[model samples]
Target: MVREKNPNVLSVHSIIHRQALTAKTLPTKLTTQVFNLLAYLLDICYSLNLLNLNLQDGGSNTIYHRDAITTYTYKFQLWNRKIIACNYSCFPKLFGMLEEALIKQTDTTNKISNQLQHLTDEIKRYFPSLCYNDSYRLAMDPFTLTQMFYRKHCKTIAVIKTKYRSKFNIASGLRSALSSTQPRIENLCKNVQAHPSH
Candidate 1:
């Protein structure tokens, strides 16, 4: 297999402009660690819909309840902070944290079951051959049985029907009528009265 490397590719700019001019005093490792934590936390929240969860449950948006965002958001911050303080040690720690969050989210009673029975059946059928991570892959597929159950509502929607009306062919119907064979005179029952001359 050939790997394509662009000749015009330039130097890596990951650390280029995000840091300040005082960066010589900045802890470069800490900055990278914080960035990693932010990335990971964003990934987990995205995949699990944490924002939606917080808004729906965790009490009405009172001052205390609204701060639940801070609580949940802090978990990600904690994950990042730990890594930074340890100087980029303990990725397993981060994975464990996200995994626990995922597990907890699954335990929440937010699932609509009747909508997902078909998906559950499919999963059961595939259980014999499935491997470890395949369950997550199958469960999260947009087209899977489970996803059909959950729907987002919208106020005004336009649906376009893509099929066009067929143009009628008046000439073909007339041609078929014109080409039909007439019954032979002798074979026509009405005309078959023994020809008196015959």
Candidate 2:
């Protein structure tokens, strides 16, 4: 009711639900892997429904059947790249696992591999600071990578500024701001300071 009263208010729904709706309405010209993946998800839903029906018919013990169903559901979720437990810090690792699974399902010189690479590139484009260094997953602090890369990019811009000092007021200005921010970032990530060259 409050949302109705306020035009600016909007309803936010679960991402999984949104994805499911979009998947259903995807154009028929989708690639082979995407088509198969959607079909596989539909099959999983059907199997789950069958499990529920069988349980209701008293075909077996409720606890054991439910446990088996839960296990299968988890496997399906992982297979579908829709893990509920995944968070921002763990996203790169999850993508790596999904890519590995995709690799197993198709050859390197296939459309599926190209699609996977495109998906990875898109993710990296959005989160370059976090996804740039795949080997830096020690802890779940995304800020560490963010600050480290921010400092690095600042230095890079500063170097470019030095090459064209007369026409580079913006880069010079950014370098000055970064100079003040770097120390605080260094203090926040002593581990990065220990291996700053990385």
Candidate 3:
């Protein structure tokens, strides 16, 4: 209805919410393995919770939101690679569970790796902005530009400082520039009597 009233208004869905929903589609078999996959789910849920907090705290800064998303996407890729290589360090709970239960890492590693890949794929599919470098470059340019601007004006600032320092009576110049009272030229002239020889 809001959009109907104002056609130019844009609507957006929460990216974290979308990710949480996508995570719900994990296979029943995958969920059933390794003590109902509690350890795995707990790790994923904890990460997501942290991500949600980051996104929530980002407030109205789209740059911060983009950064958070980009960081999370990179982490997903890293986790996928680590899982494929049989390294479960990133998911400490899952690693501990496997070690304690004498479970072969091969059994669940493939499933988890596949799910991570799927999640990464889904994120790319949904957030195409992450694929473009131009947006990030533009977002980052302001700080760079500000530094460049200050560097370019440094000589001018130095010249101004030197000119100000060379002045003999800076306070008088400032008083002339800032004073509000007008000079009483006529009164001063009237007070001066004509010269006796004139």
Error of model 3, residue 73, in angstroms: 0.9
Task: Tell me the tens digit of each residue's lDDT in model 2 across 49-135.
Answer: 876677677666634554455455444444334323321112343344445455333321243334434544554465345423434
Write down the RMSD of all candidates, one decimal each: 26.0, 26.3, 20.8
Model 3: per-residue Cα lDDT over 143-196, one tens digit each:
776576558666655555566887655555444444578878899999999898
Residues forming the 10-long window of minimal summed lDDT in candidate 1: 153-162
Q: lDDT by residue for model 1 over 37-125, one digit each (tens)?
A: 55444555463485566667745644334344444444545544553343222244445544544422221111212212333354346
Candidate number that wins on TM-score, 1 or 3: 3
Tell me the whole-model lDDT of each prediction, alpha carbons only: 0.42, 0.51, 0.76
Error of 3 at 80 (Å): 0.9
- Prediction 2 global C-alpha lDDT: 0.51
Tell me each candidate's TM-score. Answer: 0.21, 0.22, 0.52
The residue-level lDDT of candidate 1 at 193 comes to 54
Q: Top model by TM-score, which number?
A: 3
Could you tell me the TM-score of candidate 2?
0.22
Task: Indicate the residue-level lDDT of 73 in model 1.
Answer: 41
